[model samples]
Target: MHRATFMELCDLLSPALKRKDTKMRGALTVEKQVAIALWKLAMPDSYRSVGNQFGVCKSTVGAAVLQVANAIIDQLLSRVVTFGNVQTIVDGFTALAFPNCDGMIHGTHIPILAPEHRGDQYVNHKGYFSMVLQALVDLKGHFTDISVGWPGKMHDTHIFRNSGLFEQLQEGTYFPDQKITVGDVEIPTVILRDPAYPLMPWLMKPYACTLDSSKEQFSYRLSKCRMVVECAFGRLKARWRNLLS
Candidate 1:
């Protein structure tokens, strides 16, 4: 994070993370708490290691991480991870040659320590314990929606079906009706995804595995448009090394 961004985050989180100081011990400043938490997240350091660097107890470091994280999510999540105007989203994807596309949806596995019970459920096809992070990314590679905490063993289709996004779509509360003409048919605005997802009025996926030339071309175009989400995930894992492992 840049210095300006760090200070901005500190400003946003301080109000919630700040605590009253007592005679027992002066409370750590919000800056210090956020710094410790960011360091812990940016690096693979344990609570003890982070505390040693900050001249604080491991327990204090752990608490600071949890508190600061919750504070950030509570205060900043909606602003940072918003789905803006539907037309704007459609335009963004259209500019990239994907007409009527509002977003690209995908899932990535985030490795994590196995939970105490039912650890086997977290073991993925890659032979590692992980959690699934399903997300919808706009053409600019920003997350418009995200769902986490699903076991890695679960299929992407299963996770998507159980997501709040799916519920909203089912309830007809999400994107307003918008149509685009393709040949003689008018198609509703939709999100792009891989074959792992089911086709719906608002969701578009490529054809199943096939050797037909036209199907191959369609899959190629869809994959090209969907590459934005993959790049976004790659950058996320690269910037946050802790998430990479």
Candidate 2:
């Protein structure tokens, strides 16, 4: 991460990560805790190896990493990753040739070590233990919303339906009183997804086995727009090799 970005994150997380010194010994400063966590995330190393570099015990490293991670999530998630007003989202997708689209939704598998119990629940069709990270990304390749911790064995559609985003859409409060015009027809803002997802008023999927020219054209345009989510996931996994490993 860039120095400025890291500092900004630290500032945001300070409230949550700040520690009170005890009489026995001062706790590790927030800076050191964040550094330890960042190092662990940036490298694929065991806790013991990371602890050796930081001159701390393996358990301390683990605790610090988890603490810093939760702090980041609590402080930065809503601020950095959000879907703004409906008009802005519509304009973003319109620029990509996908009229009436609010965002693109997809899911990727994040591999993980098998757990002690119910390990089979994490084993996906790809024959590996993993977790699913379902996300909605805007045209700029930024995540607008994300759902994590679902077992890989679950279908992408199942994960999406169970997500908070799905609840928001069902409640009809995510983009209230907003409509988009596509040629002659007016429709509500919708998210674009693949065949794995279900078609709904707020979510759209390409027509399967399209033979009509218009349908094919629509599918082509939707695919081009939906590819943004895949690219976002690709860039994320590439930048964080720990996710891939």
Q: TM-score winner among the candidates? A: 2
Tens-place lDDT per residue, model 1, 1-245, is 78998899899987899899999999999899999998887777888999999999999999999999899889999988998788888887777777888899999999888789999999999999999999999888999999999998999999999999999977777778778889999987788998878989888888886569987877777889899999999988887674435
Q: Candidate 1 has which clashing residue pairs, if any?
A: none
Instruction: Find the candidate with the highest lDDT and give its number.
Output: 1
Q: lDDT (CA) for every model shown?
A: 0.89, 0.88
Give the range of the ten consecutive residues with the poorest summed lDDT in model 2.
236-245
Off by over 4 Å in 1: 209-214, 242-245
Q: lDDT (0-100) at residue 175 of candidate 1?
A: 78
lDDT of 2 by residue, 129-151 (tens): 99999998988788989999999
Q: Estimate each model's TM-score.
A: 0.88, 0.89
Steric clash pairs (candidate 2): none
TM-score of 2: 0.89
